[model samples]
Target: MASRKSGKPASAKPAQPTAPKYLDAKRGVANWTQATEWLRVRGIEDIECITPDFAGVARGKMMPSSKFTSNTSLSLPSAVFRHTISGEYPEETGDFRYDPLDGDLKLVPDLSTLSVVPWETDPTAQVICDMVTTKGEPVSYTPRNVLKKVVELYTARGWKPVVAPEIEFYLVAQHEDPDYPLKPPRGRSGRTITGGQSYSIAGVNEFDELVDDIYDFSDKQGLEIDTLIHEEGPAQLEINLRHGDPVELADQVFMFKRTIREAALKHGMYATFMAKPMQQYAGSAMHIHQSVVDAKSGKNVFSKADGEPSEAFFHFIGGMQHYVPRALVMMAPYVNSYRRLTPDMACPVNNAWGYDNRTTAFRVPHSEPVARRVENRLPSSDANSYLALAASLACGYLGMVNGLVPSDPAYKTVNEGSVDLPRGLLEALSLLEGEPAFAEMFGQEFINTYVGVKRGEFETFMQVISPWEREFLLLNV
Candidate 1:
C-alpha cells in the first residue's frame, strides 16, 4: 500500500487487550463483543492509529489495534497541534507539551466514519478522533472543537446549520522519469481529463474504474453523495454530497477526501485537493452550500411562510458579504490558489451574492422553500472542510445575530488594487494579522500557531526557483 505522504500511519493504534467500559458507553459500542463485531464486519485487519487533524495539520497518533477503547490514552507531541506546514509555533518546537516530547493526549474515535476500504481486502480501516487530556479535557485549537463551539451557538438559538460540499480533485498519473515525472496522456494537460466525452456525460467513462470505486465506497460509508460529474477541465471530478446537519456533513467530507485519495491511488493515479494544481486550466473548488433550520420544529429559517425571501436569508448573505474580504484566507488559503480567481476560471472573485449567479462569490441555488440555500463557491479544494464550514457558518451567525445587510450586489466590485488577496503565504499571514475579528474568531493560540507554520512554508518555497522562472528569467537575469 502507498503510505500517506505526510500523515500518521493509517493504522498505528495502541493495543486493545479488551475494550474498556468507558468506550462501550460512549456510543453504539455496547461491549467488547459488539466492538469486535463491528471491526470484523468491516474486515479491518487491525485498527492502528486514531487521531485528530486540525485543518490539514496532523495533531494526533497512529495507535496499535490492541489498545482500541473508549479510554485509550495517547500522547501526541505538542508540536503536532502547531501548524507544521507553516511552522507557526517556533517557541514550542522542542518543548514538552502533549507527550514526553510533548504529553499524553487521549484518543477517542468518531464512529460515524466507520466503513470498509474496497481497495484493501483486509481493508484496515480507521476513524478520526478527538485529542483530550488524561483528565478528559478537550483541545480547544483543534478544528473539531472549534466547530462544536459554533454548533453550540446555533443550538442555543434553536437553529441548526445545514452544510453540504461539492468537492473537486485533480487526478494525475505518476511516472518514474524525474524530468517529466507526471506523464499525463497525450495532449491531456490537466484536471478535466482530456478525451472524447466532455462536460458531465460519457467523458468520465474514461475513468469509470476509479469513479465507480468512489461511488461504492461512499455508499458503504453512508456518505450520501448525490452526484459525481466531470468538471469543465480535464481530469477533474466533482463530487456533490447531500446537505445535512453541519456536523454530519462535515464528517462526510472528512472521510470522503481520505477515501477518494486512497481509492484513486489503487488505479495508478493521485488525487490532490489543492485548490490550484493546473497552471493553465481551471482550478478545483469545494463549494459549500448552506442554510439554517429551526432545531426542533425543523423549519427552514431562511424562508418565510409567505414564500418570499426572508430577512434571515438576506442578513445571512449580508454577513457573508461583509466578512468575505477578511475571511478570504480561509476560503482560498494558499498563495497559488488565488490565481484561480480570474474572471473565467470558474472561480468567483467578486465578494458579492446573487440569485442563481455563479459569477458572485455567494450563489443562491434556485430551489423549493425547503431546499433554498446559499452556496459559497469561493472555497478552494485544498481547504479544511470542517473549518471552512464552521467559519463560514460562524460568519453567517454573526450576520443573523447582528442583522448585517449588504449593499446591493455588484460585479467583482471590490477594487482589486485596494486589497487584493495575498499573492503568497506571507501576504496571507499579513492579511490574517490585520483582521482582528477573524483572528479572534478562531482564537489567539490557534492564530499564533497557524501563522508560525505557514510562514515556514512560505520561506521554504521562496528558496526554491520554479520551472517557470527557470525557463523565463534564469538566462535573461
Candidate 2:
C-alpha cells in the first residue's frame, strides 16, 4: 500500500495537545451530571456507548449527543459475550448454555473513560461501558468485569496491584486478501524494513509522521505512553504504557489498540497486533510488569522496609510459574498465538523465573526496591487486555494467599527447546479445564464459556487446508 502524504507544511510546528479537563475536575466525572456537563462543554455531536467484547473488539451503539443523557439505557445481546473471534457463536458452550431466546444485557457507562474520539471527522466522544443485568448485577463473564473482580480480591486483602504493559505490533502493507502473507510497509526512505533493528532511532524515524499521529491520538484520549521503541522484527514497534491501576491500565490498552489501528489506516498502512504476523520474523508479545502495594500504607509489598525482596514477591513469582500454564489460554487466546511461543523467536518457551533473564517466562528486573516487579513474558499481543491482566493477577493472588514457594532462580538460559507450555489451543484449554483454581477465582461460568469459545475457534481452524499441506502431502502422500 502506498503511504499518503500529509498536507502540512514541512516547517510548521504542531500544536501542543492538552489533556482532557474532566481528568483534573475532581479526578474525574463522578456522576451523570458531571459527565453531561463535560460533553456539553466539548460541543460533542455523537456518543459511542461501547463495551469491549471477548476479542477486545468495541461493540455498542452510537447515539446523537442530545439523546445521550444520564438516564440513557443501552443494551446488547448477552450472546455477544459468547462470540468467537470470527463473530460466530460456538455450537457447544460447555456447562453455560446460550439461551435460545437471546437476552439483553444493560450497558452501564464508566464516566472516567469518557474521552474525545480524535480520529473521527465529527465531534464524537466514546465511553467504555460495563455490562450488567436488568436487575443491576454485574455480568461476571465480561472481560472488564472479570478484571474488576480480580482487582477487588486484592482490595479486600488491603493490597493494590499495579501493572504496566509493553505491547509489540507490526506495521504491514495493506492487503485485502487473507491467503497472502503480510509484508512490511515502505518507509520514508522508500524501502521495506529488514529484521534486527532493535532500539534503532533511524528505524523509528522512518515512520515519523505515523508515530506522531499515534502520540497525538493517545494524548487526546489521555493515554500516557512511557516509551516507544523499534523491536527485533521487521517494522515491528513496541509501546510501553505507564503503570497504574489494573482496570484503568487495561481500559487504556483496549482503547489504545483502536487508536493505533485508526492512526495506521490514516497513513495507508495496517497496524497488526497479531502474535506472529510474519513467518520469518520475531513474534509480538505483551509483556506485563506487575507489583503489589499496601492499600493503606502505600508501601511496596514486594519489598521490605530495608529494600530487600519480600516473601510476597517470591510467592508472586511462584504463583506465576505454577499457574501461568493453566492460564495460558487466556493470554494466548487464538490458535495462531501458540506459534509465537517457540524458542529463539524472542519469546519465552518455559515458565522459568530468573533475575533479568529474557529467556525465562518470568523475570525480576533490576530496580530499586520501590520499583521492584516481576515481568511476565508469556502473553501474546493479540490477547484481550482485560482478561490477560485478570488471569495474571489472579495467579499471583493465589500464590500470595497460599504461601506458595517458587523453585530456585534459573541461573542458565531455559529456552533451549525445553517447552513447558501446551503446544496448541486445545491442549491449553484442556489444561485450563482441569485447573479448579481458575474456576474458583474467575467464576465457573466464565471458564466454561471461554473454553467453549476457544474450542470452536480451534475446530474452525482445523477445517482449513493450509498451503503447507498441499505443498508436501498433496504430492508425497
Candidate 3:
C-alpha cells in the first residue's frame, strides 16, 4: 500500500534552476486568423513551407509570399521524418522497404498551432501540422502524433497532464578545427562558472547581458518562462518555463530551444543542448515537471489539501520508476546520452524516486498544491519533447493502473550498485528489445519502427572514428 512520505531531517532548500516567470499562469487565444493578421501586419514576405523534421522540430526557410507558401498548404517529402531515406520499417521479411520514391507529401498547417518566431525577419510565423495521406488520419507513428494519442488517452479519462520544462545548456565559442574536437569550457575571465549552487542568482553575472535578452524575448512571445539560473557547469544555464497541458508544454519546450539558440547567435556565441558536452561538467537535461488534473472540475488529480499530491501521485512515481529501463532508449535517444548519466552528471543513473531529494531520479518538490508534482529529471535537452512526454504519460498511466507504490529514496549516489542507467546505448536497446510488455504497451508496430531507427543510428555512429581515438591509439598502435 502506498503511504505518505515523512519529512527528512534537513533544511528545506528551494528547487534548483528555479525560474518563477515560467510559473505564472495564463493562457492565450489560439485563433489562427488573428495570428495571420499579426504576420501580415508585420510585412512577412513569405512563409517557407513549415514541415516537421526527423527530430520533430519544425524546419524550413521562407521566401516572398507571392513566391511561396501563399497556397496555404505546401508539399514535403514523406521520407523526411521517417528514420531513413530508405523509408523502411524493420524491412518486410527482414529486408528494407522504401516509400513512393517520389518526394510528394503535403504540409497543411493546423492554423491554431501557429506561434510567432521572434528572431525571424519579416515576422515569419510557424504552425505545426498533422501529416496525412490522400485520407486524413494522423500518421500512426509520427512522434507528435504519438503524443497527441496520449493526450487523447488522458482526455478520455477526464484528466490532463500539466507540464513545465527546465532546460539546461552551455554557451561556448564556435570551434574552427573539426580535428581538435570542441574543448570543454574553462573558467576564463567573465565566463560563467560551475559550482553546485543550482539556483544562486550571483552565479549568473557572467551572462549578465545575454540572459536579459532571453528574458525580454520570451516575454514578447508570451512564453511562460519562469527564470533562468546558473547550472552546475561552467558556462551552462538552465532556464525554467511555466507549466501547462502536456502538448502545449512540449510545444513551449520546442520554442524555448529556438529562442535560446537564436539569442545566442545574435550575440555571436554558440549554445549546445548536447547531453554530455564535457565529462567533467553536469550534463544538460530538459527536465519535465508534471501532474494530472481532472477535466470536469479542473481540479488536480494528484492534489490533496495544501497542494500536496494524493496517493495517486505515489503510484505515478512508481510507474515511472518501473518503466525507466524500458523507456531509456527514447529518453536518451543518442548513443552518447548514456555517458551523461554517469556519476556526478546530475541525471540519476537508475530508476528511483524520492521526496524533496535532488539525488533521486524523480524529485518531489517542496511546494503546496498548484506546485505539488513530480519532476522527471532524466531526458537530455536534445530529446524530442513530444516523444519523451508521451513516454512519461505512458509510464504514469502504468503506475496509476497497476497501483505502483514508491519506496524511500537513496539520499546519496549509488555507483557500484544497479542504481545506475544502462551502461551503453546497446544495453538500452536490449532493454527495449527484451521487453515484449513495453512493446505491447507502446504498440508493436511503433516499437519495432522506432527500435529499427535507433539501432540504425547506432550502427552509423560506430562507423565514425573520434579524436579521442587518435590521442590514445595513434602512438600506441
Ranking by TM-score: 2, 3, 1
Residue range 97-201, candidate 2, lDDT tens digits:
785788899999898888899999999999999999989999989999999999999999999999999999999999899999999999999999888899999
C-alpha RMSD for every candidate: 11.3, 9.4, 13.2
TM-score of 1: 0.83
Model 1 C-alpha lDDT per residue in residues 1-477, reported as the tens digit of each score: 335785767666788698454332322344455666676554456553544455564354544455664455556655566544555443433221323455656665665554444555655655667766677787766777667777888899999998889998878776555445343332222353563233656657767778788888776655677888878766778889887877777767877887788887777778877776666678889999999999898988999998777999999999887776566666666666777766656677667787777777888878999878999888888877767787788788888988999768654443233223345556666676566765546765556655665555555668767787989998898
Location of the lowest summed lDDT over 10 successive residues in candidate 2:
19-28
> What TM-scores do the predictions have?
0.83, 0.94, 0.84
Query: 1-477, model 3: which lDDT tens digit per residue?
Result: 323464554555567984333222122324544444445555656554454454656655455645443455556665566564234333332222336574555655655455555677655655566666646656656676677777887787788888888889888767776555445343324444555656667767666667778877676656777878888776789988888878777767776788888888887777888888776767898888888888888777788766656888888888888886778777888876877877655667767777777777788787777667888888888788888888878788778878988776656654334646677877887787677656545666566666667767777777779878988999998
Q: Candidate 2 — which residues are off by over 4 angstroms?
A: 1-28
Better of 1 and 3 by lDDT: 3
lDDT of 1 at 473: 96
* Ranking of all predicted structures according to lDDT, beginning with the best and ending with the worst: 2, 3, 1
Question: In model 3, what is the error at residue 185, expressed in angstroms?
Answer: 6.9
lDDT of each: 0.69, 0.91, 0.69
